[model samples]
Structures are given as structure tokens and as C-alpha cells.
Target: MEIDQAGKTNGQQPLFPTPSSTPPPPPPPPQISLSLKRLLTIVNCLLLCLGNAGGPIIVRIYFLHGGHRQWLSAWLETAGWPLLLFPLSLSFLYRRRSNPSAPAVLITPRLILASAFIGLLTGVDDYLYAYGLDFLPVSTSAVLIATQLAFTALFAYFIVRQRFTPYSINAVALLTVGAAILAMHASSDRPAGVSVGGYWKGFVLTLGAAALYGLVLPLVELTYSKAGQPVTYTLVMEMQLVIGFFATAFSTVGMIINKDFQALTREAANFGLGETKYYLVLSFAAILWQCFFLGAVGVISCVNTLLAGILIAVFIPMVEVLAVVFLHENFSIEKGMALVLCLWGLASYSYGEYREAKEKKEQIASPQVQTSAV
Candidate 1:
């Protein structure tokens, strides 16, 4: 047979064809529609509520088991739960280290300053919340605090990149109306031992905390998403933890210096506990746990997570009701009204989410037909 001109004279074919280096197809952009986003928001808010409610329950348990201030002081001194997160945070840091293609978010001094502001504001909000619980029923706190969702929506619209749709606006209005009714109920149900001034102070503190917290969330979210780094999330949370740790620590120290610590220890020790130090430790543990959970919420969605904390609104009121019933505290018609309004508002929020989700699904499906026809 004649040798083919295109073939190798030795009858050996090339090991590889001429390589055609075509660039890979670009990835599709993430599809985030308003409806889908709203659903995520509602879900996030619900989880936050549930997580937040746990904090009060833990505090109650620590005192019930004869905890004391020294223990709380020491627990805080140990670097708290934020220290515990070092491992996970390090893992995230390392994983991203080799990611050369990661999105560029300028971690400038300005951003760090903003992060600090958000952290400080967050600390203030939680400080007020913790302090208010001392004077007011958790129900009252939860009810008044529900206004945070409305406040957050406003902050997100003005500060964050999120555009407020008509539905979001209506959700805020409905939630506000429902929360106002709940607040009215709380006012009516105030116990005899709660001073008018104390009640008002608690009210103002909770509201301020909620409003400031509302502002903090979106900013942190903007920073973290843009930065795409664990450091930003860790940094903001660490600042809040540091601020909270100091504030609480100083307050505990003041109590010790003023001799209230000894009095509390003596009282708790009389219950046959060897010392009141255990109580303090347990209390610190509880707060530490709360800090960890709350920080996790921030990692997910700043504003949405806080709004989802309204889930606590549901349980907190019920928990308070149960505590009052057990302790022979008076319950009134307003509490009933408040609970009803809360339930109604929760249902409305859920319905709105469902409706939005359905719309998104329909839109996603409708696009397929047009694509096929084309």
C-alpha cells in the first residue's frame, strides 16, 4: 500500500490532535429575585427569634440553680465563647487563603471604622436588652422589641443596597400595627412591683436597642458580602463580643465593689450550695452561649437575621405567660390581645412570604416556555 501523505512515514499517528484551547463558558450570575429574597428574609427572622429566646431561658436557669457573680466574672475573663470560635474562624481563613479569584472588597480603614461602629451599636442594643430584662417581663421586652423589624426595613432601604418593595413596606406596616397592639397589652399587664419609671426606662432602652441594632445589621452584611472573608465577620462579631464583655464585666465588678456581690453570694449560698461562685459561672456560660448563637446569626444575614429574631417574640411572650402563671403574677385582657395580634402578624408575614415565593416560582416556570418557543 502507498504511504498516505498526511500520515507519518513510520505509520505512527500523533499522540494528540492539535489542541484547540477554548475558554470555558462563564458562570451564570446568581438569580436573586425580590420574592425569593423576601422568603429568605422571613425564614432568617424566624430562626433568629428562636435562637434569641434561648438566652433568657438560660439566665433563668442559672439563677434557679444558685449561681453567683464571681463565677460569671471568671467565665467572662476566659475570653468567652468568641474564643471558642477561633477554630472555625481559622478554618475559614485558611480555606480562603488560596482563593486567588476571590472577589475584591477593599478592607480599608473606613470599612474597619464602620465595622467598629456597627459593633458598638450592636453592643449597646444587647446591653439595653440584657439590662431591661432585669426590670420588665420578657413578654414586654419581646413585644416592644418587635418594632425592630420596621426599623430594620427602613435602615436597609436608606443605608443598605436593598431596595424596599411595596410588599416589604406593607409587611413593615402590618408588623408595626400588630406590635403596637402587643405593647398596649404589655402596658396594661405590668405587675405591681414594677416601678413606672423602671418600666418606662426598660421600654425606652429596649426600643433604642432595637433601633440601633436595626441600623447595625445591614452595614455588617454589606461589609461581609463585599469582603467575602471570614475576617470581616469575625472582626465585627469580635468587636461586639469585646464591647459586651467589658460592659458586663464592669457592671459585675461595680456590683462586687459596692458589696452587692457578697450579698448575692450569701443569699444563693444559703440554699445549701457550697458557694455562689457556681451560679456566676453558669450565668456567664449562659451569656457566652447566647453570644455564640447571636454571632452565628450575623454570619448568615445581618438585617434578616435580626428580623427573624421575631421568632423569639412568639416564644418569649408565652414563656413570660407561663412564668407569671406559675409565680401567681396577674395576667390581663391586654396580654391576650397582644398574643392574638402577634399570632396574626406572624401569620400575615408567613402568608406574604408564601405569596411571594409562589410568584417567583411562576416567573421561573414561565421563562422556560418562552425559551423553548425561541
Candidate 2:
């Protein structure tokens, strides 16, 4: 943050750090093209939608089809990380082609460690989610997952001092209430073949997954702020690669310990979906989960963590409907009410953000207009 008479910092400022009492930032450099930024943002949103809508449903498909290894399911969540190397390598090649003097790798050691730690936590989150999905209906799980936005907002406020408008406060209340309403009749809609004890365990585990993931998103944004380098989509992908690797490794250890690797063949042979479809389901689950991480990180890089959480919440209903249509999971009246309330909450938060952004734009414009007139 050092500056000379030129009024420039010694290095590039990290992307989107929270404002402090320090002096105002120097004008932002012309970094990525605005059009490209928009395009990337659009692409990332689509990826987010794909993951949020498909990931749980696919993971549920595995469980519903007689796949019962929690570690295996968690492993699939990050196993497709190898898919990232293709683009990352190309980014390296492009960097080399464009600037011969630039470093071949963009990842820093500190960032690696940070990403690794988060990845470990992500592994735990994956297990919690998988455990919940084991017993809870996907429709039930989806509603609980939507409660994540409230947790995200809470964490964001503490971590980034994110300003909360009335709308967001209302959202937090509604989302919490929606989740609570589900809790009131948690045993009433238990999936067949699941005991009441198992149902409660799944309910608690799913909420734990939601809360942990809520923390993870804000932490990812915090990492970008402290990354000490320009945050770009490529760099975000690089960080994601590291996170995925570590998370997969963590789960791999569990799979080894639990003998899940050995159980896969037996599970596949007896899979209700058939052996061929079993492998296909696992493959799709891995790829889709990777898409989920990619989109989540990409959105965090493009905007902020809460927006990413909002995007995830926005797709929860889609996930719920998909669960009903594809998995034929139970969809009860309570779930319907929960979905309605969660959607109402999401809409409130979105409008609040839009309203704040518009007002801030007008304020900035008003100052410039007054200065010009003077």
C-alpha cells in the first residue's frame, strides 16, 4: 500500500477489499475488459445454476440408487478437479505466449496454503452434505440448503462488515423462519426406509453443511482480498484447482480408511440404476460438483461472497423441483411452504442489493454533476 509522489501504490491492490478509514484508493487501473468481465460473469452464473440445480439431484441419485459410502460421495464432490488443469495449462501457455517475461505459474505459496485449509473444510462440508442426503429426501435437503444465505449474510457482516439493509434483515428472518417451519414437521415427511433417528441426523447434518458452506464462501472472498495479487478468473481457477485437490485428498483418505474404494464394485454391481448407469452417475456427479465449485469461486471473484450465496439460494427451488421430477422424491405441503418462503426471502435480498446499488450510483453521479456545474 506504499505510495510515492506519483500517487500509485507499490503494487496492485487486491480486488474488492472492504473500505476502511484509510485514504481513498487511487483510481482503479484499467484491468480486465468490461465486456469480457460481463461475459465471464454470465458464464459463471450459468455454471452456478448448473451446479446448484444438478449437483444435489445427482448426488441424491447416487444415494437413492444404493450408493451409501459417505466418503465416496464426498470424494466425488472434488474428484473432477483434474478437469481444471486443461484450462489452467492453457492459461499458462497463453501467458507465456503473450509475455515471455511473466511467470509460468500464477499460484502463490501463501494462496496455496490458504486454499488448502479451506479445501479441508470443504471436505468436511461435503461429508456433512452427503450424510444428510443419505437419509433426507432431496426436496427436504434443498430447502435446508437455501437457509445458507442467512448464514452467509451473518458471516459476511462479521468478516467483511457487509452493510445490511432492511430488506436483507427481512430476508434473514424469513429464511430462518422457512428453515424452522421445516424443522417443526421434520419427522412427518421422512423418506421411506429411513428411521426417525436417521431423519433427524440427516436434518442436523444438512443444516451443518449449509452453515459450514456459508462460512466457506465468505472465507474465499477474504482470501482474494489478502491474495496480494490481481484477482482474475484464471487465478481464481488456479486457486480452485488447489482447493479441489486438497479437498479430494482429504476425502480420499477417508475412502481408504472406510474401505469405500473396495466397496465401490459391490455397490456398483448391486446398484438399482445398473452398473453402467452407476459409473455414469458418479462421473456426472464429480463433473457437476466441480462445476459448482468453479461457478461459486468465479462468482466470488466477479462480485462477492453474498452474491454467490444468493445465486446458490436462487437455484435451490430448481434443485427441489428437479429432485421431485427426476428422483420422484416426496414433496409434501410443508416443503412447498418452505420453498415459497425461501424464494420470498431470496427475492427480498436481491431487491435490497439492487436498490442499494442504484442509490449509490445516483450519489456518485450527483457529486460529479455538482462539481462540473461549479
Per-residue lDDT, model 1, residue 234, is: 37
**Least accurate stretch of 10 residues (summed lDDT) in model 1?**
70-79
Judge candidate 2 at residue 366 and give its lDDT.
Answer: 100
* Model 1 CA RMSD to the hidden true structure, in angstroms: 8.7
Best by TM-score: 2
Badly placed stretches (over 4 Å) of model 1 are 1-47, 57-80, 83-115, 164-170, 185-194, 228-281, 284-316, 325-328, 364-368
What RMSD does each model have against the real structure? 8.7, 8.4
In candidate 1, what are the lDDT values of residues 110-162, reduced to their tens digit?
A: 55665556544544555566556555665676676677776666666676556
* Model 2 local distance difference test score: 0.86
Task: Report, for every candidate in turn, its global Cα lDDT versus the true structure.
Answer: 0.55, 0.86
Give each model's clash number: 12, 0
Model 2 per-residue lDDT at 324:
73
Candidate 2 lDDT at 372 equals 98
